[model samples]
Target chain A: MSAPIQLRPDETFILNVGPQHPATHGVLRVKMEMDGEYIVKAETVLGYVHRMHEKMGENRTYAQYLPNLSRLDYLGALGYTHGHVLSIERAAGIEVPERAEYIRAITVELNRVASHLFWFGAFVMDLGGFSPLMYAIQDREHILDILEGVTGSRLTYCYYRFGGLYNDVDDEFIEATKRFIPNMRKSLKKYAALVTGNIIFHKRLEGIAPVSAETCRKYGATGPVARGSGINFDVRKNEPYSVYSDFDFDVPVYQEGDSLARYKVRMDEIEQSLRIIEQGLAKLPAGPIMTEKKPKNIKLPVGDFYQAVETARGSFGIRIVSDGDKNAYRLKLRSPTYSNMHLFDETCEGMLIMDALAFMGSLDLVIPEMDR
Target chain B: MGGYFSDIFYGGKSLLVGLSITFREFFKPTVTVQYPYQTIKMSARFRGHIELLADDTGSPKCVACGMCQRACPSSCISLDSVSVDIEVDGKVKKKKVLSRYDLNFTTCSLCGQCVENCNFGAIDFSKEYNLASTRKEDFHFDLLDRLKRLEEKKA
Candidate 1:
């Protein structure tokens, strides 16, 4: 496409890593200029899975756009939905009930753990560990069942309404969630022993494809990628959205900034997420789930409102500009993966193909979300 | 030589630990439900394709307000209503009754907007999940006919 950008001498051959490769995860294509095994220049080609989510938001009413947020990141659907719902709530000035906020926090944290488990499995699989994927997916199914009990639909959950949750969690859901926490902690221990402590995993990742904190900042790489590079900037702690401020959880930061460091950050985040879920369950107040006052028709008061939340990947920001209409004048979804994926171009320069691929996995690229 | 030997020892030990973890889990019963022979119970809040609800007298409950038709983002739902004379307390009165409620299931996002927007509890999600079909036109659900079919099956 466009004559390969006129490669200069000494760049060697060009290696393309799929607009449709398993290792690339989703429909992401990386154009890597290679000299035998070492990559000279890497350019990530996107927009393969772009469904124009922002454009779709403009075409539909604010309430109807709820389902579209989940499609952005299926692995962390609730977090995106939570961010969108918060922005809509802010725009319409709808007050969310205390119980609703607690439920939102609990579900969002659950989703974060699920996303990390999937990443852990897939990342390990990328490094030639097959059994961990089985172990990880098996554990992940439990979390899905627990979520599906309350939210319905396993992947693209459209459970959150404009004001609060679409429906209240049943007693069985709460009990199962409480039971799942300790079990997941046990699973984490197994994962640590299975993958984290394994020599092969360390050998493949540690000190390989090192991304400096400066590089992360340059690319605006938030979430585990930034946290891996010793950046203490989680939107949960830094910005403090929803009921995240109420929970006492530490942001795990590693200075190594390698693939292993990002791995450790995500693993530690699962523990922190578990801690948040437990606290949320314990302090869940008994009150109205939805706000008593019905929200008025969504008409933004001729201003732009931005709401940001800590998704599993990073901080997902939603910007809504309404020209006093039921539909948004302009809706911009600031996907975290887009910024994270941009790091691949600069970071993967002059690295081995395998190590760069490993580094890409560590970034946890959801191609659809990036393209969105 | 000492560092090399120790590195070998620790790496071997971690590998053994990983093996042991898998070994213990191997004895556990499989989590996968045997499909074709078994099916998981659908949740109450499970959002499936929208279906029409029936009143106690085996009549369609839809008042045909057209809120769901308007509220749907994809515009997958198409409602057709007809006004007919009905005997009411020794008097003839014209009443709006649902003729057809068609859902283009391929375009349906299962968003629950139709169910939420409806003032009367005349529509709900049918727990028909394992919807595998070859033809695209097969998904075009006529809820009125589906309701009568369900009623006959129940009887």
Candidate 2:
């Protein structure tokens, strides 16, 4: 070396955002390298909330392992459970009844709507708006009441069995759901007028951390993240698992991949989900809720099986490898938040700290799900 | 300058729209329920802690099958059975009677696996939501003893 190079003081500094910060939502830390108010690099430090769910899955029987999927994403727990149940059902070659399929489709769509509504409240709260959360939860209570009346729990509903639902939804459940659809529509209208056109929301989100379609594909961001960037891909539409193919609905796509684009995508998704629920309720057939002669023990065939479902966050996939034993040989959970959070490392670079936080919130991260 | 004024106008319009909704809702009845003094009723299917159901003769209906113990993900349940003498056709016969049923409530996830596994309908969910205690021992419950005491009190 010719000489020691002198570096200027205060040129850059490392900011520990949190394994404890409120903006992080959970035990997630961002070791961000900062130059003044802007981020030079942001590396997400996960595993603070890791429970090694995959290892747990391999050791336990399918019945024992079913509830673990719901804990991964409590805001939209049913979708992850659905993926796992679907995979195990495919492996075992169990024939889920048409009535069960229709009920599952309706409940899953209702769950998606509940998830997006909660996210809207939480996302706004992250940006310092509190009233929206109150309003959102107030509306979401109707859904919880309806589901709880049938499933017996609010969040983390382990409602679906391997072949069908645990029990049937009563006529009261149908009446409540039918009454809720129009009321939720009115709430959505109010939300649009209140927050969508607000100048403060516009300034905070519009054109901030613009993620292009290429970036989304490179990072494997699905659901609203990809749809926000004009990628016309949705697991429900493209793959058409369950009775989704029977319903006619539009997958909303926004050309702009900014935070606002993601926001608009989720809002529009709520509408589509509502439409699916409407159709499902109308076509709710009469039959047995469960298949006769249910197997006492579940032993999947010696092979790998997978199923993917569109959760509120993104596409959640569950893959299982069975050795023809009661327990799975290997279980892999492909959580959407894990891939979605990785986009932060590249996309959040050079963004203002505030904007970075807003962008992080827009991703709708569930840190435990990502870590698990 | 024109664009700035139009933006402000639209922003104000949106603000008024939000304010109007809030203003009209001020007259509506409050939704918050007061805890302790006022309580919401639990749904018919509300899942809580596992409870041992009683038979017509005021004894536990459990036959000590151990299906629940095997099916529990957390291994939170343990039970013991004893041979009891009974008269059948005026002759002494041996039958298994449930002697102990312990529940490790600390590890219980309230998944309702025990209820589903029971073919005899010996268990159900008890609507015990106000569970709070300091000592760990309070959580480890002897279901057989509790059932006996409950039956005695009812009698």
Candidate 3:
């Protein structure tokens, strides 16, 4: 047997960064090992907000569970609502009207833009910059105003249906969005001026949380985080759905494996998303937004179906296992934040504690979605 | 030593540029809205809460059509309609009366599906969404609350 080696005292300090810390973003607890201020190891502990949404899905009918989808990403409720509704429509193989698809596309894109704006604000705030949060929120408020006009609620909007929309978009809404595009474009420039090229922001974010392409591919980091690291995978482009095929837009990519690269990628995508919205508005087809095909008692066929959509955080996928009943047998939400955040333990290693918090911010985690 | 100087020079330049922006914004119009005192007006279009309404006759406009109950995806609403015998002009007439109307607001998605499906336009969403209570029982809304108030007025 080899002789026992002596270890020095105070080589590493165990730090509990809490299930309630502001940087952890939710009830997420990360136990970190630190050598002074530098984090040497991190382990994430989840399930603080887990309400067993999957188990609840099994008990509730397909239609009955529709409302629960918005609760997952409660901060950006529309993204969750859109992903679930789109999945149900795909699974049932129902034909939605052209007008319905157009409306759905419009609302979703608006929601995407709103969600990204919020993330942009929050990300900068995490980096100790405050002005951009208020500025970005100002633009985000306009998008909410447009959605509220038709959907009748601000956040956690349950305005989508399986083969159609809950209501029709009014003429005022059309005019409002038309005016909003220019205003939003102008605001983006201001956001760039405020934080994009700032020295402190660049220093804090550049070359930090370096998630390589191989790592992103291995872990399936979708949305901006993967795109920032030179991954050319976008569910909208790869698996085209709704009226997205009809619209013309580019998928923005950044080859830099850093938080700054992720920031730039999200900002560029926001511009591209605005262009998609513009095209959607211009060629929005006129017809009934709801299908005449309302199935009795919310029953669906028994089968396993997978549907993925681009959310603000990443690629949001819903996998439903149905047993030919009014409700689902099993519903699993592949939340983007959940996958994106798993990298936190690996990336936070050998970084300052504050830098780890900044990295968490860059990932743009929504805790309920992660817990769910 | 040369690289250190170059980095310092670039860092100083970057700081100056950022400061210029700060100085410019300082002179610009302040956009902050004092939320409570000087309120930013929320539009009428803002959909906040779901409310049950009554018609001018103080009777619920919901005709027990069950359209709302059917359209609800969450099944948070449980409705029961009963037929009542009424004597009008010495003839017995059957009228539909709402026996039980239960809405679990906690489970409701605020999707406005029930409101949109109502052909009779009986229900609407109120702008009041500050709905928080200590007990789960407090979330349940009874539409007949207004009807009972009218009955009290008649008395």
Top-DockQ structure, candidate number: 1
Alpha-carbon interface RMSD for all candidates, in angstroms:
1.0, 1.1, 2.6
Every candidate's TM-score, chain A alone: 0.96, 0.97, 0.95
For candidate 3 chain B, the 10 contiguous residues with the lowest summed lDDT are B143-152
* Candidate 2 C-alpha lDDT tens digits along A1-372: 699866687578899999999889899999999998999999999989999999999999998997888899988888888888788788888888888888888888888899899989988888888888888999899999888888888898888888887889999899999999999999999899778877788889999989989999999999898899999999998898887889999999999999999999999999999999999999999998777867568998888888989888888898888899999998998999899998999999999999999999999998989998
lDDT tens readout by residue for model 1, A2-60: 67676566659888999899999999999988998999999999889989999999999
Candidate 3: RMSD over Cα atoms?
4.3
* Alpha-carbon lDDT, every model: 0.90, 0.90, 0.82
Better of 1 and 2 by lDDT: 1
The best-first sequence of candidates by lDDT reads: 1, 2, 3
- TM-scores for all candidates: the values are 0.97, 0.97, 0.90
Q: Is the docking of candidate 2 incorrect, acceptable, medium or high quality?
A: medium
Model 3 regions more than 4 Å off: A1-10, B1-10, B20-45, B65-83, B88-90, B99-107, B116-119, B129-140, B147-155
True contacts kept of 2: 0.65
DockQ score of each predicted structure, in the order shown: 0.79, 0.74, 0.51
